[model samples]
Target: MTTPSRYVRSKTAALITFPFSGGQPRKGVELGPEALLRAELPKQLEQLGWGVQLDRSIDWDSINNLLTSDADINSLKNPRSVSKASEELANAIEKHARAGELPITLGGDHSLGTGSMIGLNRVYPDVATIWVDAHADINTAKTTPSGNLHGCPVSFALGLDGSYVEPFKSWLPNPPIASPNRVVFIGLRDVDEGERKILKEQNIKVFSMHHIDKYGIGKVVEMALDYINNGTSRRDRPIHLSFDVDALDPSVAPSTGTPVRGGLSFREGHYICEAIHETGSVVGMDLVEVNPLLESEAAAQTIAVGCSLIRSTLGKLSRLISGETLLD
Candidate 1:
């Protein structure tokens, strides 16, 4: 039998979509939110018995009343815009989370994860986080070589070194939104030298492709869930899954800006979501970085795969229950 979510009071999913991509210097990534919507994301969730609360009431066009000018601070691009947008996204997520509705945020970039983690933490203060991506995304202001805020959202979420600096601190809560002990990463293959030291110094948990190859995806996920849950039970704490499309192999999902080679296969990616669904502890999820403009030829394929992954995360679709798949 499938395990029903303990957090949702009703079968309602807050389809929080944002098109702000000020975090990175990519024009196509901002179109991700609309791409997923055009793919009938709301209807797909409704088929799984969810109400699909599509709330676009927020005036995200103004960047949440930001005084942002295309200025860079501390080598960061669009710091004010990203901070204000993150604050707005965080507030929307917190509202839905407080209403006992599942918040499935469709993001403009992986930087949206900064909002996801911060907002969910407001409700579930002890929420466990699962970051799925090819990159570690733990780069700090001092560590970031490109100055793209997309690569530094994890640092912002954790309040790592240089995270408490200007613009972000004005809205961001005092760091450590979710405890470092409750955060974990999977599918990591490309990690910067600075990010490597940060991960090691902070004692964060990570399962790279090397680990996946050595112990298999199943064991890696099991260990990740256990660590986040403090080894008590996989369902012991609320979970927030931040999925970057780059985690999947370039062949499986090639529409992303930073496509890493030899990433998760179609089945491997779905397995992570399905496993989390089985726990019934996932309260929030963010599907980010599906840049359709980058790969026009394969954009349709990437969108289809992204939608399928979200479905697997939301319900018992790709896995067996009592010796039978849901479709069977």
Candidate 2:
């Protein structure tokens, strides 16, 4: 039995997997959640003393049923099904939050952010999110050139679709999880022309590669943490970290569904997570778009190491020796 404490307590971390591949044009991102598990992520976290709850499978059949009903020529994949799965995911995350447990979701794709963010919002209501990725995922169905749902999750979360009817409407009744001012994007480099316009007009805080190059990652992370944690004296709202694996340099994490050039170095990525851990307000996190099929054996090993770095974000590390400091 675990008891809650003041600063820290025995925490529960759930590894929730949704194997839906329809979000992206690519097929293998659905394998991401399982691939992380096969790499022994649970055991690693267990070594850090978190009580691990593994929701190995979600009902993809239920998602299929909803999608089939809402299928369209323009929207080839089922919006109804995707929304349904998101709702279920939301419910699960809400349950974990209410229990005072930390939830760490694995990727089915970036589209799953729709569900994960919704779930976090339901629990914390005033929650803020940190979006770390190579591209700005803010395209609507009309705006998306590829018609891939993965590219449109941020738009969906923000409720920006022109065809806001039926199943799609149920996904997000409100417009966006956090206000544009509240959200911060880091490590962006490969944005579409329209997305660049949307990001600029909305005044969303974007720390692009150029910004990082000028300001340094340490300063960028400091600004992000302060922005999210500001003005909360008593009970701070939760912070949801949506980390697209593609935010990392392709050389470091090449197994993603979309590999972009010029992303965060391995140390930079780990430092972001480590700094978030320092804040102690992170409630939920998602590591998305890791496509093992696109990887070689060496690439898979690299991703597995990267996943370990995420564990560090949740305060997972080897037990300290008697004389060793945490900083050591």
Candidate 3:
């Protein structure tokens, strides 16, 4: 018999759900992925002529339970379980990327970044990550006061120590997925004191609200693009974008578990996503930490619309129709 084709056509986008919510002290983020899906995200993309493949069978609950049981009572909520869930998520995302599909991940929480980045790194060793959030998320276990793993994913993904125990070593890779230079943080306003030291010490590029205020979104994005795309030999180095809903102002997305004030405006957030899409190298993305329980149904609907708008920045609903701009 003839061998089956090794490469399936990748015209469809893969929606991978990660529903674990143990990253922070809250419990509602576990429902984020499902809520976004129910918001008719697939139909929206379908309207733009892209096929949608929903992969929602992830065992987020089991992962959450495992982490909660193994967690240190005082330090963090669920360290081991978060790491375990990340490992599983990494495997799935890696599989999809290797198959040449665009992997769009729905987060259980921001900690999912550890697993998601690991998976992307396995497929594209030289990949870079663009972290869009209100907090730096670079704090390690030694620096974190809240013990929220969500604030430590960047550290963990870079192989820095956090709340993880000895038994969870295998869940994280040795060198992690990204280097300090390869990662860029944008839209930050609320930064912990320890996180500030680590960021300055590592010389990690951070464009905080002050920077945005000085340079404007367009200029900031231009600088960010240059920073992330600099010195790469390959024409297309794989890009993984980690988007926390809290990156937007609480006025825009109040349903996030950790809403920070003085964040990016809706247009600013969309501009970031659009600029990244313009790079033509984005292969994976994550929408994280949206909590429906924190808001009314109407508010959740608004947040859902914002999610759709962000997805559009990735060309989710964009079409190549003939049109003239106002300038034209």
Taken over the whole model, the C-alpha lDDT of each candidate is 0.83, 0.73, 0.75
lDDT of each residue in 36-83, candidate 2, tens digit only? 888888877776666898875567777766565655547535566666
lDDT of 1 by residue, 1-328 (tens): 2334787676788888877777777778878888988999888776665688887855676873562465888798888888877888889999999998888888788888888899999998988889999998888888899998899998998888788878888878874664667679999999999999998998999999899999988999899888887876546678899999999999999998889898998888999999888788889999999997975768888988888888888784733354444531
Poorest 10 consecutive residues by lDDT, candidate 3: 319-328
lDDT of 1 at 142: 88
For candidate 3, lDDT tens digit of each residue in 108-154?
Answer: 68988888877888888878888999989888888888887888888
- What TM-score does structure 1 among the candidates reach? 0.94
User: Candidate 2 at 327: error in angstroms?
Assistant: 15
Runs in model 3 deviating more than 4 A are 1-9, 161-165, 231-235, 316-328
- Local error of candidate 1 at residue 215 (angstroms): 0.9
- lDDT at 52, model 2: 91
Best by TM-score: 1
TM-score of each: 0.94, 0.88, 0.89
